[model samples]
Target: MTAQEAEDFLRTYRSMLKTWTMAVAGFSNDDSDLLYRQLEADQNVLADIAISYPEKSYSVDLLINSRSRTWAGYAEQRLPRPQNRQS
Candidate 1:
C-alpha cells in the first residue's frame, strides 16, 4: 500500500478504537476513566506506528492476527482483501 493509504487506514482504525473504547466506558457502571485513558494512549501509539511505517504494506496475515485480538474480529469481518495487481 502507499503511504497515504496506510496513513488513512491507521487514522480510521484509531478512530474506531476510540469510539469503541468510549462505548465500553459509557456502558460500564463502575469508574471507566482508566479504560478511556488507556484507549487514548493506544491511539497515540497507533498514530506513531503509522508515521514510523508509512510506506509499509500491511499483509492479510497481519490483519487476521489483529482481528484475533479484542474487537479486531469485527474489523477483520469488515475489511476486504486488498487487490493484488501485476505490473
Candidate 2:
C-alpha cells in the first residue's frame, strides 16, 4: 500500500473499530473509552510512520498485522496488492 492508501485504510478501520468498541450495551463506558483511546493512539502512531516514510509500506503493514488479525483479514481484502510480474 501507498502512504495515502494506508491512511485511508486506517480511517475506515478506525470508524469500524469505534463502532465495535462502543456499540455493546453491556460494556461500561470506561472500558470502551480506554480501548478506543488505545487503538486511536496506535492509529496516530502508524499514520505518523506512514507519513514519515511513505515508501515503508511493509513496515506499517507488519505493525498493523501484528496488532490485529481481524484487521489484517479485512485489510487483505481491502488493501491493494502488488500485481504479479508475469501477469
Candidate 3:
C-alpha cells in the first residue's frame, strides 16, 4: 500500500472506532468483529510500508506499534499461571 492509502486506512479506523465508541458506549460483538477485520487488513499495509524509510512524520501506525509492544510486555506478565499445591 502507498503512504496515502495507509493514512486513509488509519483515518477510517479512527472514524469507525469513534462512531462505535460513542454510539454503543461499551464493547459489542459487532464492533469487535469490525475492529478485528480492520486491524487484520491494516497489518498487511503496515508490513509493506515497513521496508521503506519513514518520511519524518508521526503516524498512528507508528504510535500503535510502540503501544502494542508495551502492552504485550505488560500483558504477558499479568497472566501468570498458578502453581499446584501439594495435598
Q: Ten residues in a row with the worst lDDT in model 2?
A: 21-30
Ranking by TM-score: 3, 1, 2
lDDT-best of 1 and 3: 3
Per-model TM-score, in order, reads: 0.34, 0.32, 0.41
Root-mean-square deviation of every model: 15.1, 15.2, 10.6
Query: Which runs in model 3 stand beyond 4 Å of their true positions?
Result: 17-30, 56-63, 66-87
Residue range 4-79, candidate 2, lDDT tens digits: 7666766766564655434332323445445556665766667676777767556667656644554323322445
Please tell me which predicted candidate would have the highest lDDT against the true structure: 2
lDDT of 1 by residue, 1-87 (tens): 455756676666555555554454343243334544655555544545545674443432243244235643333245554568342
lDDT of 3 by residue, 14-84 (tens): 66655444333332334544654666566655555544526513555553453244222222234543567
Instruction: Please list all clashing residue pairs in model 3, or write none if there are none.
Output: none
The TM-score of predicted model 1 comes to 0.34
lDDT order, best first, reads 2, 3, 1
Question: Per-residue lDDT for 23 in model 1?
Answer: 51
Give the whole-model CA lDDT for all candidates, comma-separated: 0.48, 0.56, 0.50
